[model samples]
Target: MEQASRTVRGQGMSSIKEVVSSWSDVARLLRGGDSGALVPVVIPRDNRGLRWTTLVWFGLWALISGFMLLRGAWGPIAMVVAILSFILAALWWWRSSIVEIEEGTVGVLTKFGAISGPGLAPGRHYLWHPWARVAYVVDVTTEIPYAAPVLSSPTHENVPLKSIEFFLRFRIVDAIRFVQTIGAGNFDLVLSNSVQDAIRQRSRQVRTERAYDLRGSDVKDMQELLNRQLTRYGVQIMGCNIPDVQLPDQYREHLATRERVAKELVAYEKEWELTRKRRIDTLLMEIERSKKIRDAKIVEVKASLNKARKDVAQMLEERETEAQAIRYEIETQARTNLVAAQGEAKAQEQLATAYRDNRAVLGYELARRRLDVGANLAENAPRPVIVHTDAGSADNSALSTLLMAQLLPQIQAGAASRSRPALRQQPQPTGDEVAQAAGSAAQRAVQAVRGRQK
Candidate 1:
């Protein structure tokens, strides 16, 4: 839409862009302009004026014509002047016979009030008859703008819009058909009607609430339709659009209120979303903290269990060592007691055998001593001598027990002393001598027995 308006607003015409350059061109376009709009191409002037160089050259041609008319008639000098003037004038007229049209314009020809040959291109041309001339000029290069505002057009909902402005640009393609059929001045009404109808039809298809959608929407279908209608008149719609659409004031106010409510709803939704995200983040942090605490507790429990197992193992080893030591001590004491018992039994048996042997030897020695005493008594008889022992006294029993134990050696010594002197004296003896000696000996034996009994 913006591009269309910019193009339409660019109506910058060139210096020679006068569609009505003269009164003849105006009469041809307004009154009898059906054939074409006419411009002077016969004289071959630019901007409808002669330049300085052309003016100077034209003065020389006037001097030649004057010399041809005023000089004497028959002299050789006059004849030569006439011949030179004729050549110069003929060349000058020949130069003027050539016609020219501008580069962007075309010229149509009409002779004796009838259409002649094809339109002349923009360059040098010559007319075969004096009656032939360029009857009109048509611009073929420029694009002209047309903007028409359709006011209070009815929509599909029967809602009449305030206004819809349509704009377009067009160029003349068939110059002869354009000048003969519909000239530039009359094409204004036809273009306005076409734009109004197209814009109202488009406005009808859109809802009243969506009227602004037409501002920059494509108008390709509408442009094609307009081209179909205006193509016979040699005009082509180069570009077109709906550049403006004005809605009712009451409807605009309603739209503004609806927009404010929609914005408020969007703001509340965003705030609620933020609050939900913050709560989710806090919960996640708490879950991580609890997991760390649980891991710490598990590590502590594992350490305590390992320590208890190590202590129990140490106690079991100490008890086993003590048990082994007690068993070894008991075995050593039992071996010592067994050896001591065997030695004591052997010593008691030896003591009893020695006691029996000594008793038998004492009995044999006493019997032998008794036999010697009897023999000596038989051989030597002594005069009657008596020695007695009282045997009933307790005192005598105790005295006999003591005398046997202490007086045996003393008795043996006394006998031996007495025998020593008898052996030194004579050997033979008489009855009295023998009797005396027998009496002594018997007395001594009685005394010895009495000592024993005492």
Candidate 2:
């Protein structure tokens, strides 16, 4: 009822600016507005942009006046003095107004009804009193912690899920923007929502497999991407990291089986390839060795053939020389035979000539035979035929001597016989005996003479 009476009294005040001239008029306006009922009436009154010195001056003046009245002094005079003291003290305090800013602290102060500065320093400063007031104080050195949310395919193909989480570190860079956009009280909410949004955006572009296969480096990239996007809100993102990734049971089993089969197939193929290459290389080496042996044998045979040819040539030369020597010997033997034949013929002719030259040898041989016979006869005969021949008669004397010799021997014998008878018993030769001896001797003498002459 009291608030209704005040409203009625303030109705005559007309404009809002004029109605709020005193504290009671302001209270009445506040009471008339239903929206301002719950709000204490002191808030608008206290937040009237009043300086600290103004409040102090008002209190000092009130106290001095009360004290003067209690002492029972000149009340009116003391009241005037008290009001002047209060005004002077207010002036002094206004002249001594100070603004303080600390490190990592921002202070915005108003002075003389105009905003002075949002000073970023850590010390005391002065500003004009009465209209000067501290508008805002900011703690510039605060750390922000945040996180990223990610969803991945589950290991089981049947149950793909969204259960992944990460963390981030950030700071407030622009104090003014941070304060204007979202108050410090809502800072955590803003950062969390922004990071989660960025993660979802980035995740949509990636495949489910990629998210499931995320590693430490991938987690780091997520942090960097989030930082860039969240920087516009005066938020300095330090790091965004993923600590864990979750998958469905079925998917994990399938992936493991696939990897196992691939590894086994690769190993088997590699072993087969190695074995085949070794076999081929061994065959090639054997063929090369065989070729080398064949070439060496061929060279050996050629050398042997050359040696054989040389031996045959030597034998042929020896045979040719032997044939020449045999020819020479045969020729020499023929010459020797011819010479021997000629000598034999010459010897035969000489013997023939010697035989032909011996014609008188036969007469000499007959004479020798006769001489031997004569010697034999002489030895056997007595000496009875002695005939002498006259030297002058020569040819005719020989025959005559022969006849006379015969006759004379006969006559001599006859004459001796006749003389002997007379002498007494002398034996005398007979005529017949004498004649026979003379005739034999004469014939021997005649034959000898004729043989000697012939």
Candidate 3:
């Protein structure tokens, strides 16, 4: 409030000091400057026409009192009157002439009881003490808290509501109108009345059971309404709301009962949905199990069918092998019989041919038979001991003759023994006779063979 403010050329005046600084401003302010720099409210206690008169009177009064005190007045009443006049002039100078406004507070100035041009900014200012004065000081910056708790308001159905507590915060927007139109002392009544009226209108819009909707709901409409109604009075509603509401006891109990029923209905719906899902799942599982059983049975049947086919094929193969073996055995037996019969026929033909040729070869056959008999007879006779020697060795020949001589006796003994066997066989032939008989027989066989050759 003590800061010096800038004064520009065309911006006009911002302080009371500038308003009364010049002769023209002082003249205009004396003519009831109700059009500028102060609240528009009129006081009508002081007059603008007596602007010079009041100033001259104020100056004269102070001078006279000072002169009287300096001259040392003798009368007691005169001294007291002069002292009071000075005191009055001082009080007028301090309270009316000087305007000292604090920060956040707007100052309203009255020029001879008429509001000046506009609200005064925060700062100290000097004005015509006897004519202009600061009327009201208002804090325009801070918000004011207010509440209106209504009792027994009716709803749209005319259902009686218990209570509705309304809360808000407000601040001043127009300092001049706020202080002049509605002072701070009576503002609370106006605000409370407006709040009650708004609450009633809101309650009438909702049903009794839904009155709780008023609480904890965005109340922009209500707040806007209050702002419109109270705007002229310079009050700006910042935030307004219904913080609490109450219903009748019986209505509260009924709402609780309805809530419980609704909750039970929701629970039953969920349970039914779960049971249906479970039933579907169980049916699907049964179908799957049946499908698996059918597949297993089919596999078993196919396996058995394959086994039967394999067994049949094996039996057929065994029968075929046995048939082949029997055919082979039969063929082998027939071939053996055929071979044996053919051999016997060939042998008989050869034997008959040999008999037919036997008479033609009779002599040769007889000689061969005689030679064979003689060879057998010689082989059966006792062997003589003969000496072997080289032809050129006479001594060896002599020794051999001697050995022969010695062996002649033993040989004669062997011949005697042989003759005894011959005597027993009815006469043993002499050697020369045996030789002559064999020769005669050979000569006859030769003649017979030569005749046949011719």
Candidate 4:
């Protein structure tokens, strides 16, 4: 019953409403949902200048008001007309100047070739134009999808890579160049084709191995190169992304086999290395054993030779000792005889020298006696003493007299020395009383000298 009621309600609507509902239903089907409230209107096939025509009508009224106000209308009327004219001009200019640039940005301008902006920040903007017409408004900022089609090479044994779609988020850097080169009417086609060309060129230049390598650095390099190449066509490849890489079923099998073969080869090489090492070890052991045998034989021969050498050395040493003893005896006898000869010769030489130096000997004896006298005086005398000992004093009176005279001079010198005050040896006494005592002693000495003379 609910289904029937809904059916009646749907049928009760006017033809127009039903038509709109049907359109909504179609939209819901496309969106994969149920339509609730939506009206559909027929879109004009020739959507050329419908909006422009409407703007023109409104602008024409304002232009007429502006002319009337300038011809001396009332003050309020003139102001209103002027305001209306300006608004209409602004509106027409905005509509004309507006353009859909790359990335959904709009551009505005005036009729005198002056760019009216605030350039479109995405959606819509209104402005005025005097003489200029908006040339081309294009969506220069749009993601251009690029695909590099690379079929697998059958001849190559290396891994095969499949076709890949590369997404490039791009914005038109140069609007003028984009419209001129990319043809405003067929921009999408041109953009897609250009992107495709660049991708193919770059992909072809790089080897298949590098692409499948999945190296981050390699992908970045390719993206940058693609951007730079496309920049000349006013297409900025903002980002190039590799979302998927499709591989053939057969390629998967081949890859698996290659991996298996690689693992097997590694194992086989490892075993071969082990075998080689064993062989090398065995050879080394044999060489070592051979060296040991050779060394043993050499050691035995060396021992025998060493024993024989010891015997020979002992015999040689005994012979050498006997020879050394005989030589020592001969040398000792010869030295003893030579010493005896030298002693005799020395005795003769001494006799001849004694005879020849008799006068010098006598003079030396006299000097020695003088020296003894001086020595005796030095030993016995507490103070200085003179010694005038003469060598010929026993028989010569004049010599004796001369010696006595010398002694007398010495005695006088000693007395004079004794009379002098020994200031260095004594401490000075203090006060006049000590000085008086010193004077009295001096007077007594003088008196004694006088008494002796008498």
Candidate 5:
């Protein structure tokens, strides 16, 4: 039994050694690989887990120290425990001096009631509470707005502008100067005063009507001027705005009345213009219609005139044809008359030539004329006159001669009568010659009959 107890004790001692070695490894890791040295660190107040750990450690230490005191253990171990508790309490109090500056914020540090350095940046920083202090934690990134109502004369002509609400946005650029001059608590008041002063100074140069027109430019000018005033105190003006403006009641009413009258006049002019344009359009349409009618009439008249001219031309052509026919007929008739006259003249000339060339034929023609005259006389007178010829006288020369002698005196007397200028002075035949010729012709006829009877 003694040997078995010895082996079990040895096994328990080995397990205890293993446990102690694991704890030493953990402690070394926490001390940054040096078991005998402590790693310096800064603790952030905003770390909730570290804050809780510190609270729990303080509670545990107080409880342990109270328990030791209650047991009346006033020995070296009690003193050691008290000393450790005091040190932990001191560390916990020191942690309270640690300041955590978030991003975009600046921590203004002051030592012995004066600015110590430039400033503290973002992250955890140690500042002793009594000796060294964080005077201000300024939010340099956030823009602060300041607004106020102002009253001023816009035109410097006694016309006051009221209830003009102006706004200014600004931020702290130099935290040290901000804390030294204006401080965080009075930042809004200082910015508001600067904005009001700038607006008042700029407003006096513009009229109320021009103010509205130059609102944007006015705001920008106000921002620049405000920055000039606030820059010395570390306040930078970001922007300025005029959000609202109001005119006096009387002025507003007057403007409304004028606008209403102007609109009525404009409407009247538009109606008059429309009526005039309508009349002009109607006149143009009438003119177009008249022009079309005139053009049609002109075309009709032109056609009639053309037809009349054509008819006149045709009638003239027909008249010319008739005249030509008449002229041709007259020419033909003239030529026929000329030919007939030429033939008649030629026949008369031939007859005169034959009469002049042959005397025997003339004598024979004269004898025939005398015989016809004597026959007519015998038929009219109381006695008959005849001439006889012998049968043996085959050439009737003697009879011919007797007839010529008997007709010559009568022919001569006729010729003389035609030649005389006056018919009353013409020579006449004697009655004796006429009786003798009759007697001779009768005796010859008696003898010829007697001879024939024997």
Candidate 6:
């Protein structure tokens, strides 16, 4: 019996050695020829123990199987129960390694105690449970808002300003950094604090009225400032908004009162301007009327002056005509007088010249005048007849008278010749005249006789 047992043990040992050699060859084949060859590589697993509950259940199953074997009841079934208990323990440990990352979210991984290569993307992912953990499962797509408290104004140093409500929208950009610094569970609280800090700092630079008016720009500035702070924690700020603002009641009432007073002052100024314009208009109208009156007076004076000048001109013309007529009359009278005086002087000269040239004619004219006077005396004298024949008788007056008559003519001729110095001197007649006178008497008697006889 001992030899038979030894032979069987030798055969079992040889079979066990053959299985070990085959396993070594399979390990060498998996290792490949070189380090750079394309071959499946196994990562080193973390050292982790099974869960206490699994171990306890496995121990309980082993104990049960051992007790069953000691009692010699269904030995193969007890072994199968023990093997199933080990499998149940393995599956229970593997449950933690099975990770399901939801859509739009990523799972950050950590091996042992340090961060691993990259984050796990959405879908089913396996990890070494209890050693490699899903550090953080962050939603990189969804935005989360952080609200801040009311802030004060910088303009009014002591005055409390409006209550400003603001919100910051953010999303996780780096899941690894987010897990390392601000974990997903604490992101809201940390972002809220950062937003409050940004609001407090930015509010100090803006006035209350300006903050209310430019709320959009103010919120945008807060978002940018908050992002600078959150970037360290792997968070990004997407947007910001200031929804409501509330001011103090007292300040609003003060502004309203000031506006009302300004409106009243403007109305008063406008009324004063209107009154001044009316006064200026009245003065302008009076000035225009005075100018018109002055122009009319000037025109009237000019007309009067022109009429006076015309009258003076006419009077001067009439005076000149009368003066010319008087001058002409005086000149005509002077010329006529001159002509009459010249004619009279010329006639006297002619008469004096004729008398000087004919002195005998002048004597003849004087003699003729004396003869005419003697003849007239004789004609008027009375005739007396007386006879005296005695020669020496004193009564011979008749003969003497005849002789005187004959000599009278000769005496007048001699007197006329002596009176004119231009006439020739002549002697008086004596005996011849007496004899001529006696002959002439005798002849007269004979003729008287002859006439009687006849």
- The CA lDDT of each predicted structure is 0.62, 0.54, 0.66, 0.51, 0.59, 0.59
Give the range where candidate 2 is weakest over 10 consecutive residues by summed lDDT.
12-21
User: Model 4: residues >4 Å from true position, as ranges?
Assistant: 1-162, 165-171, 183-188, 194-232, 236-245, 274-329, 341-454
In model 1, which regions exceed 4 Å deviation?
Answer: 1-18, 22-95, 263-454
For each of the candidates, the C-alpha root-mean-square deviation to the true structure, in angstroms, is 26.9, 32.2, 22.1, 24.0, 31.0, 35.2
In model 6, residue pairs whose N, Cα or C atoms come closer than 3 Å (at least 3 residues apart or on different chains), thus clashing, are none
By the TM-score metric, which is better: model 1 or model 2? Answer: 1
Q: Against the true structure, candidate 6 has what lDDT?
A: 0.59
TM-score of 1: 0.45
Best by TM-score: 1
When sorted by lDDT, best at the front, the candidate numbers are: 3, 1, 5, 6, 2, 4
Compare the candidates by lDDT and give the number of the best one.
Answer: 3
Per-residue lDDT tens digits of candidate 6, residues 64-163?
Answer: 8767686576666666677777777667677746766666666667777788877888788776556676555555676644455454433335456556
Candidate 5: tens digits of C-alpha lDDT, residues 282-331:
99999999999999999999999999999998899889889998998898
Q: Write the per-residue lDDT of candidate 3 for residues 1-454, one digit (tens) a residue.
A: 2132212211222211112232223323323333443222222222223334454466566566656666565444455555666566566555545555666666678777778868778787777545666666555765655667777789999988878888887878897887678765456557767887898999999998788898988889989999999899988999988889988888878977887898898899889989998999999999999999999999999999999999999999999999999999998777666654555454444444443444445555567667766865775566666656678866755666887778777866777678556546654344455445555554555455444433
Give the C-alpha miss distance for residue 122 in model 1, angstroms: 3.4
Superposed Cα deviation of residue 351, candidate 4 (Å): 11
Task: Compare candidates 3 and 4 on lDDT and give the better one.
Answer: 3
**Model 4, 141-249: lDDT tens per residue?**
4443333333442213344455544554556666555544644324433444554555455555555434554322245666677666667666676666655554557
lDDT score for candidate 2 against the true structure: 0.54
lDDT of model 5 at position 266: 88
TM-scores, all models, native as reference: 0.45, 0.35, 0.41, 0.35, 0.43, 0.41
- Model 5 pairs whose backbones collide: none
Q: Of the candidates numbered 3 and 4, which has the greater TM-score value?
A: 3
